[model samples]
Target: MRAVITTEAGGPEVLTLDDVPTPEPKPGQLLIAVVAAGVNRADILQRQGHYPPPPGESDIIGLEVSGYVSAIGAGVTGWRVGERCVALLAGGGYAEYVAVNAGQVTRPPEGIDLVEAAGILEVAATVVSNLDAVRFKAGETFLVHGGTGGIGMFAIQYAKARGATVLTTAGTPEKLDLCRTLGADTALDYHDDWVDGVKEATGGRGVDVILDNMGAKYLTPNVRSLARLGRLVVIGLQGGVKGELNLNTLLGKCATVTATSLRFRPADEKAAIVSRVSDEVWPLIASGRIAIAHQTRFPVDDVRAAHQQLTGGNHVGKVVLTF
Candidate 1:
């Protein structure tokens, strides 16, 4: 099997293409002939040696994959060899094949191409789990930072599907337009006074929920933009990690602040997240209520270029590498 091996902890330049042994499924996993794999920020961080795979997991670099099951472990059921599916993985997605846990696998929605399916699991699971954390309700307004990216686009669509009014912040007009196309009722320019824009849009009432990636950079404004009992869920810290949080502000609005990362979660927790996303969000894809926004595709050998695209901050959706 051919794979993009991380020869060392460095830039994308370190990714090397090589023929590696095909990985066989363990007792509780499925060996998938890889079609495509989602490129995530975590993948880039891992390449730089900042994030390592969990204990006993593959040292290879992908977090999610979409392909057909080529072999199944002895105890796996409800799926069979040759079944088209997408799955979350502990690691090893940057290859021609990946062994995925049966419990974390989801049948590809009908009509979704394999490349597009590759963009689903990670973003879907992330958005759904964070949305769950906030207990988002229909008719409520939710604000998402980084609205044109994979997770943001997923959150925008899912929130809209549930009848929530969605708003988002993006640094470019192109990105903001993409967010609007994805169902955000309003898309503010993150480069500007986003808080004022959001406040004006809600007639000074603020939003019920905020999905933020910039973290500390948006912390103060995020606090000021929340309505009573609002929930702010932070999933990325692309800005800065530490900030003087205003507890009084939070208390005054009776809001809540929470943060999470999907890659570091335990297996059972990941399995449960996958199950819930498959059960609740998969139907939307099948029915066209939700769609995968796959913006770019690079061959497995050009993973370095893929990483460059992500780091360039020019992509509007999920970037994928195909086998």
Candidate 2:
């Protein structure tokens, strides 16, 4: 099997296609013949040696994929050979084949292309699981930084579908417009004082909830932008890991701050999240309430180009590697 292998921690140039032994299904797992794999910022981090797969998992760079079940392992039932499915994985997606626990697999939403389904699980699982954990309400205002990225775009639409007023941040006008098309009520340019824009959009009341990926860079402003008793969930640290926070402002607003990483969770926990998405969110997708996100494809052999494109931050929505 052909898989993208990194020679060392560095740039996209380090990623090379190499022949590797095919993964076999273990007990209660499935051997998937991967059709496509979703590229993520985490992959870049792993390539740069900032992130690594959980112990005992594959060292492959991908986190999600759409593929067909080639073999079902012992104790796995209700799945047959050759069923089209998508999976959320701890690792091992950037390859021609991957072995995933059966619990992490679900049928892609009807009418969605199998190839594009590669882009679905990671974004959907991240947004849905986090929102559910935070108990985000329908009438509450929601803001997500990096609105053009895969998770951000999905968060915008999913929040809107659940009846929340959605706001997002992007660096470009075209990106902002795309967010609006996907149902963002307000799209603020991150290059500006977007915290002030958040305040202005909410008429100074601040938002009821925020889904931020900027971590420490936005911590203080995110706290300042919260409405009374608002909740802020940090799921990434793209802007840096450490920042000062004003406890007084957070105290005054009676807000709560929490952080999570979907990629580092245990398999059973991932299975639970996968189940929640399949039961609750998949309906939204199948009903077209959650729009099919913008997708960009790169051939698997050109995985280096795919990494470069994602790292360049010029593409909207998710980037996928086709097999």
In angstroms, how far off is 203's CA in candidate 2?
1.8
List model 1 lDDT by residue over 1-323, tens digit each. Answer: 89888878999899999889998899888999999999998898899998899888888999999999999998988887898999998899999999877888888777888999998899889888888877887899999888878888888999999999899988887888888889999999977898899889999999999988878888889999999999999888878788778999999999999999888788788899999988899899999899878569999878889999988867778899988
Candidate whose TM-score is highest: 2
Worst 10 residues of 2 by lDDT: 308-317
Relative to the true structure, candidate 1 reaches a TM of: 0.96
Clashing pairs for predicted structure model 2, backbone only: none
Error of 2 at 287 (Å): 2.1
lDDT of 2 at 238: 87
**lDDT against the true structure, each candidate:** 0.89, 0.91
Report lDDT (Cα) of residue 140, candidate 2: 92
**What is the per-residue lDDT of model 2 for residues 14-89, given as tens digits with 9 covering 90 to 100?**
9999999998899999999999999998999999999989899999889999999999999999999999999999
Q: Given candidate 1, what's the lDDT at residue 259?
A: 92
